[model samples]
Target chain A: METEKLFEITAYTENQVGLLSAIAGIFTRRSLNIEKLLVYPSQIAGIHKFKIITRAAEAQIQTVVLQIEKKVDVIKSYYEVDNERSCREIDDVRQFLQERETESNNI
Target chain B: MEQKITGAEAFWRSLLEEQVKVVFGYPGGQIMPVYDHYWNYQAQIRHVLVRHEQGAIHAAQGYARASGIPGMVLVTSGPGATNVVTGVADAMIDSTPVVVVAGQVPCQLLGKDAFQEIDLIGMATPITKWSYQIRRAEDVAWAVSRAFYIARTGRPGPVVLDFTKDAQAGLVDYAPKPCHFIRSYVPDPQVSESQLDEAARMIDEARKPFVVYGQGILLSGAEKELAAFLEKGAIPAGSTLLGLGALDSGNPHLKGMLGMHGNLAPNVMTQHCDLLVAVGMRFDDRVTGKLDTYARQARIIHIDIDPSEIGKLVPVDLGIVGDARKVLAGLTERIAPRTTREWQMEPILCDAVEKHKVIEPEIQPGTGEINPGEVVACVAEAVKGEALIVTDVGQNQMLAARYSRFVRPHSFISSGGLGTMGFGLPAAIGAKIAAPERTVVVFLGDGGLQMTFQEMGTIMQEGTDVKIVLLNNNWLGNVRMWQQLFFQERYSCTRMLNPEFTGIAQAYGIPSLHVETREELPSAIRQMFAQEGPFLLDVHVREESMVFPMIPPGSSVDEIMLNNEDWFNYGD
Candidate 1:
């Protein structure tokens, strides 16, 4: 089995409560677990956006978007994949490399 | 032919006919036309000019929550409208009925990179129950009506109506059709009898039954129905934070609030009950600490007006989607009331009372420093079921929740879902303005008070006779408490320096009372209620006090660490 990584997806909606519930309902019915979710107004264009972190496959992501669009208030849905090359990953790598350097210096 | 009137005039007239008494707003360039119209209808509708647009929206929220009526807010285009987004979102989360009207740039200038031409509809989409952009002047009445309907109807929340400059200025052959608009959007409040019977049967048959009430009690004007149901059934009722005023605090059937910082009795009973009847509340994580363990002992029945809310979190054994008051009324009519295992339930109530008595902090009569709990209890006792209480975020809110005694729906107002600071003062002002007959009080910490302390001007200007009870702990009490417990007393930026709140209130032309000792509280409260205009009672409390039985974030309800527990005995 492949290791699943949690990715935060920002789905834009026309700020309505039922929209978030409907989108979550889609994932819920499919047995997709949402790890963490936060919905707030976006900085741009004032559309309501959700930051939902869930563990699912790429195919599942596409399906989530399609289902989300079916909700009356949702305008668009997109994901921010948690990649190793991301800034968070870079911080981790830096810490690991620094630890190695410290060990070598001690030796 | 009908007399020609601008859309702004039609909007104002429609609002007046709807019995809208007050509107909170700050004027700006694009929205000047509406303000111009506001000048004409000054007799019917009073417009309060807030220092900040955000404050105006929050005031509307305060008013809405207090009055049980939809609050109206008006803001200009661009930054003016954008600033109110937080207030609208706050109202949405807390389920306060608010109608936000924003002035947009001219229709022709839209998408033309014109100044103050931001998409108000697009911006307000997520933070509103419903949002609409009015392009034509003729649509003004319909849009305003729709906004009010969406705001005050089932699952009440904030609704936004963005009027283009052209729409506001354009003339229309307008006849104010208030009755027609209301008739078109009025929600049917009937529930299926079979479903109601099934729900009642489940409640009747259960060995241990628990009832959970939320903001829907106030929104549906169902306090009478809820109280009657609890009284007749003998079933214990618990409330979400937003549901504080649904049942009287001293009611024998009441089980206190259920959540992260909820009483031990309610939390324990939630898990122990056999049948859990959740009305008008989505089982948010705050209410149900850990999903799997929440109501583990119960078979749940969820009832809400919004179909989406039913079974959104914990799976329900029976889901009834309808208005809470109507569903409950139907259920009450169909089902004969029966006693459960009275012996088993009596012990639970006794234990809860015993625990409450034990946990209540004792105060010495002449102590120079005030006890936060005692002050809250004092205010709660002073208000005595008459005042509308609003609380700011942090320890003040929790303390108010724990200690305050509320007897009716819409009496306790706070930003529950968003937990926004600087919310209490403005909200209290709005509440007081909305319900001038009733006393309005706000419980605010030193830190939270300063965040929107500028609203002192709103109270002064409006001459709102609101009593602000400031719990002066001189610190960000909740964060400091958390730091002491979790981070080994690494108090960072949590410590707040000083402010003479009494002096500040005096500057705003409001009378001030300073209570340093517990003995002074009774007299201070008396003085506060006696005064004419707005008053501030600054109670100087002990800084090191912490709210106990706190279930830390991401922790299970059963894993709560009581104050009696040793530091090492942290985990369940």
Candidate 2:
């Protein structure tokens, strides 16, 4: 039996103009409403990493990833279950900075 | 100083390198640089001055459809670019390869909303396989080469390259390098051995099997191999509208066409077949009448080059993502021959053909006047299945599709998915330009012909031999037929008041003949074909004729209206 779960798809793509919208269009066509999207320069100089989060069944996410990887600019793409992720958000750093500032004030 | 060339010079140089011989275009303020330099290269490459931008694109589509090569279209910016959106969408849906070049304002004034400037890349993105705007002159050669490669390779469609005025005029060091690879784009996905094994097993096991194919066979050039496979397997075949000419119309293995207004056998027998081997076609709603009841009993073996199309509309038991020709060749090796005879499958199909007999009188000549089907029949008899047939959408298109016999590949070209009414005339011009050796006949309605009638000037200027059989039904027969059948007979604006087409053709320096009665059609068609140059034969057809075997809207494939009684009974 297939059940829905959160899946994270990470892709490394050439930083070209309009490529973002092209990737977004893939998600839109699949009826996969993206819960989160993050774009930043990858380890390579000219390549960018796009990480998208959506809730879908396993078979559906695999199909979506194959479609994303088919784009000319996309270097590679893969989907992972929620537990497979190890990451941080800028919002978490902001909270840590606020906590340190309060500690300094208390001192 | 190192060698340097202008952007326009590089652009033209790249086309020469790509071996593009003909380009359909119209000039305006923004595209003057290319036009100015065009004279220098006129002897090497020919540029067709189309009357409108839409004609350029549709001609490109027709050229692509006829020749299996990427057609080229060059248009000015703004409205000129927008006018081609319809043809671009049509090419995208039908998978015809075309490269569209549009000139834009100078780079500095791109987003300032300058005169004749629009966001062409943004507008063309959804319609084309790829869209890009080159800001630098150095990018011209690479971009043009990539545009051609992308448009012509793997499931071909239209691609757009937007050129700014500065890019078209600027000079830079010129070096031409052919683009053979993109880092991430894979045109052919590797087919799996396991999938083929499973498919071979399914075909060998299933006793009642049916084959339905589409344009992919032509795209991959698998027609001969596919014919052999069908003959060996003893599987009956059906075709999509675009797949009409993939095999000989009279091939014994061919059952009939499959769609909304397709032949009765394939549509009726699809659900009952145990194994459905669909090649090259995506399961469009038009092909699959009602999704819930369409081939539900069958285990579908879908073979196509496009991976995404697999299991998109209908589920697949064994999906092989590869070129149709390659996959069919592979399947032929693995699957054993079936000894079952051809007559085993004939009884049901013969029954379907017998029921389809009602279509004979509707198209045949009657006492009232010349039937539209008779006009197509006359042309079919005259051409004898050798000419390339292009049809405009609606009544005329349906009649031509139903009545005509197509024996050659890529012989039937029209706007199937987009249903653009103005496609036939300009596309016929493209077909003639691409395949000058073949006889190109266009079947157009009075309504559709008027939409792109200006193309008569292009045909006259080019001096191409294209026979136009204008099926002038005074009413917009398809729309009126629908309103009469489904919409309580209120035909609001479907009635057309047409001008004298013969007179219109005369003004464009093309000869024409008119035939309104049944007796005149046969001779008029011969006259139209006998002319060495372009000629138009205006055929006046009965206003009340309706195409039969039509599957009513929101109805299953089995529920086809064969006659007036079927239409009336469904209303109750």
Candidate 3:
């Protein structure tokens, strides 16, 4: 199985304890393992941000974004799929190598 | 014959008649009439004059969470009303029942840019269960009654009622009507027979089945039902952090906590289980580790109170959206008790337990310098099953969660959702107030203790028998720990200027104990517990201590940095 690259999403929130637990609970009930999460006060006055990383399919990523929007304190949440370029390039190389090998074998 | 009364007087009288013992608030110009009416009911009801309007709301929250009754708070126009927003949001997240009454500017001046005028109803709309602005004196009784009704029913949350100056001052013959506004808020507890059957079949067929419980169990008051279900089915269960006390930790079927920093058994079982039954908990990233790998082998059955939680994350084979107590009771009635003895699943569970046990940290026995871990471990060992422990935010909170052995439900109360730093002190006050007979211990770091340190006066004034264990690290340990791990040890603002906590405690007229060593902890704790009134234990602890097995931000659970040298040696 190919190892999928994980992406981290960070959302700013008001400083509250249950906020992280609520966010984590959302992921737990959905059976999503948060790879890593860090929450602290933001540079902006009085706001706190939680940076969470997890691995999921592209479809599931969209679902997570929507689910996060429903959280009470979340002001904004954004995520970038890390290592997408490397992953796509690796897949392309593998496919190219396989096709070349198949042609040689036929010859 | 009933005498004629103004709307404000009638509202206060109705509240007093309902046996509302106290109201938390601060007074202001727009609310002068209401406060005047409030004086007449002073004999029947008490008013706590809080320094900050926000504090009043939080105090009410403490009372409600402790007493399991709807808490009441009254704040005056504009800034006074806006100050209570934090408390409202806090109550909403924790499912605390609170009724916040905010004084609005006069009706005629509402949109005329009057001083201290605000659209509080609009500001509080998203955070409250329901919100209303009383336009007329006749509407006062209905609004107050409805606010209480909506706050206490269903999932239970905060409600706001903005009373116009006119409504508070307007005179009309008023009689309080019975609350009928919450008729639609009632929740259905029973799961359909088909849903029950499907969940049962999934449980019976799976080889490695695991159960995950959340705060919904407590919200639904389904502890007894859940315990019975787990015992009968012999299903190994784990709880989300919020679900800490749902099942007794000593119960053979219980698998401790699940998620980031969760027990190894639950984390591994989650991945290997053929079937997973998640009750009342929304899937959170901390619990699941990595979505792609989480419960890959399991067909999920999600039972929750909120309908939106279903299929929000992991796809569920069966979704039962109702109250946890009702659904579990229904499942128990329909499903036959099954023994996993035939499958001999005990060894699998035992092996998981045996593999995950951390060897006791090698420190010189009875060393005077307090190791933060040992102090936490000792507290866990001492309290074991009795005290309801609340921790402030930062490393202290994480350490407490890690070391504390929670054997009963509601035993561990931390700001899991918000991770609010000052939460521990006030929450402990609330928990103790809720269950006075039960000892409440609050653990706080030096930094966290300072945030809501003012509440120390509240404790002294109430003569509450709550114990505060201060972990004096001399710095914001969590940020410093992260700095050490990720920021190359350049500690910035994490260093905290010292305070004489013992003197602060003494100034509050509370007994104080100071401990600088692990040997001193038990005796200090004993001394504090033996005291007649509230006590604070200021324990000096190592500032450099870090929580191990930390999954660095954006990393998977398997990529944990185990600080325990033995666990690393054992190749875990």
Candidate 2, residues B335-394, lDDT tens digits: the string is: 889867433454365344534455667665368878888888878998889999999999
Candidate 1's TM-score reads 0.83
Fnat measured on candidate 1: 0.00
Candidate 1 per-residue lDDT, tens place, A1-107, comes to 43566777766565543465556666776788988889887654446668788887765665576446434355555566754333453244345345545654664
Candidate 2 local accuracy as lDDT?
0.85
Every model's TM-score on chain B:
0.94, 0.97, 0.91
Q: In model 2, how large is the Cα lDDT of residue B171? A: 98
What are the candidates' interface root-mean-square deviations? 20.9, 14.1, 19.9
List the candidate numbers ranked by TM-score, top first.
2, 1, 3
Candidate 3 has a DockQ of 0.03
Write candidate 3's Cα lDDT for B1-572 as tens digits.
66677778977976865568878778998888889988778888877676567667766776776566888888898999998888788887777789998888888897788999987876776577667788788888777887776677666789888888888888778877656422113334346778888888777777777789988887778989999888778778888877887787777787667766666556656665788999988887767767766676679999987555787768788998788998888777766677763433543553444344431431223454576656677776677667787788887877677667766676877666656677777667666766778878888899988888888887787787888888898989988988998998899999989879999999999899888867667888778778877899898987686666555665544455555332322122
Among these predictions, the greatest TM-score belongs to 2
User: TM-score of every model?
Assistant: 0.83, 0.92, 0.79
A2-73: candidate 2 lDDT, tens digit per residue: 799999888877788987887888778778899999999865567688989898888787778876766666
- Per-model lDDT: 0.78, 0.85, 0.73
Candidate 1 global lDDT = 0.78
Residue pairs clashing, model 2: none
